[model samples]
Target: MKYSPLLSELISALTCLPGVGNKSAQRMAFSLLERNRDGALKLSAVLHNAMEHIRHCERCRTFTEEPVCEICRHPQRNESGLLCIVESPQDVLAIEQTSSYQGMYFVLMGHLSPIDGVGPADIGLDELEARLKKEPVEEVILATNPTVEGEATAHYISQLCDSMNISATRIAHGVPVGGELEYIDGNTLTHAFSGRRKL
Candidate 1:
């Protein structure tokens, strides 16, 4: 059976979301039309408003409606003199959930992938360098993912920090708090051993 033109368009649009394929999108389109038209309208309105208003934070590159994100504007975070560099805005949200870190953040938006043509300049290293030179940041915590590209990005940022006479430290990559040693991968096991502290 052929879907109506508007129904087909709605299904296609829903498939653009991550993990939502054609089948899932079709199901969603059907469910919205048959069961929850009001909810769908609300979703459409919110999505349109967000698309129109949301933009990257000027300082951290995180999604926000304001010029700078709330974290960047917080005076106490600035006083901490710590800058945590992360790969994405989601990473910043994850770190904030812990409530353990009291510092500002810089979102890279992505890792360096030479094969993909990503470079230091592409990931906002120039802006970071300028911030380092002007701000009183005493330490930079590289909280990028543990992928190969993430490692390279962290190393590059470390060297940049060194050139500016600032300290840069990579977040430890190792086993989780409750993870069993037997289930851990070799690379993660190695990192856990290498990052071990005297306890």
Candidate 2:
């Protein structure tokens, strides 16, 4: 069955989202038209508003609406030199959800994926170094993902820290707290074993 031009356009636009294919986009488009036109209009309005106003924070690179992010502006967060370097704004949200880290964050927005032509300069490593030099940062936590690109990025940052004499630490990657040894991957099990602490 052939869809109208407007319906085809809606489906095509929806397919731009991650994990949303042609079928999913068609379903979404039809659902919006059949059941929730008002909700769809509201969503469109919000998306437009956010697209117009939201931008990366100057200091940390997280998404924000103002000149600087709230976390960068907040006076209560740790100012004594602890910084967590992460891959994206989503990582910032995950860490903030923990409520355990009191320090600020530095979002790389992406890792070092050379095959994709992304390098240190592409991910704002120079800006990070500038921040380290200008600030009183005593330590930096490498909170990049556990993937190959993430490891490369972390190592690169660690080397930079070594030259500057600043302490750099990688976030421990291991099995989850309640994970069964048999269910976990060999790499994760090995990491957990190696990172084991004295009980």
Candidate 3:
């Protein structure tokens, strides 16, 4: 028997999530319908609420319910001579897991991609520069992913820092080539931070 239009649409919508194919979407839809109607409703409600309530923090660009995220609001986090640069909020979480970095962070929200027309402006580089000038950051760590694009983005930022006369560095070689910071273990991340070198 064919499923109703609404059910088919719901299953199709579920495929928007990464790695969820049609089969998995269908299974998820069936599971939600069969044994957990209330759970499914709660899921939908949470999704809607998060979409409406969560916004990028003005300082770090991490998603938060308030104007500034918890990290930016923290009193004890090292505000002076801070580190600044990241690809995403997940990267921030990964670094936080290590508990080794005490400096403030600035999320890029994206990397520089010339082909994709994603330039420095697209990722809030202007805001980053402004922050660097306004804040007392002695070092800026470029913690982008270990990919070609990530390297290019880091290089560009490093050059920008040279012009601004701010000390800049990149995370050390403990991070595997082509691996993302979010995927690396906390211990490795801690080592990388400790061994960071000048750009």
Q: Which candidate leads in TM-score?
A: 1
Clashes of each: 0, 0, 1
All candidates' TM-scores? 0.96, 0.94, 0.84
Candidate 3 Cα deviation (angstroms), residue 71: 0.6
Instruction: State each model's CA lDDT, in order.
Output: 0.93, 0.93, 0.88
* Off by more than 4 A, model 1: none
Q: Per lDDT, what order, best first?
A: 1, 2, 3
**How far does residue 83 in candidate 2 sit from its true spot (Å)?**
0.3
What's model 2's lDDT at 168? 99
Model 3 ranges off by over 4 Å: 174-199
Better of 1 and 2 by TM-score: 1
Better of 2 and 3 by TM-score: 2
Q: Model 2 misses residue 128 by how many Å?
A: 0.1
Task: Encode model 2's per-residue lDDT on 1-199: one tens digit a residue.
Answer: 8899888999999998999999999999989999999999999999999999999999998999998998998775657579999999999999999989989899999999999999999999999999989988999999999999999999999999998899999999888888787899999989998998999
State model 2's lDDT.
0.93
Ranking by TM-score: 1, 2, 3
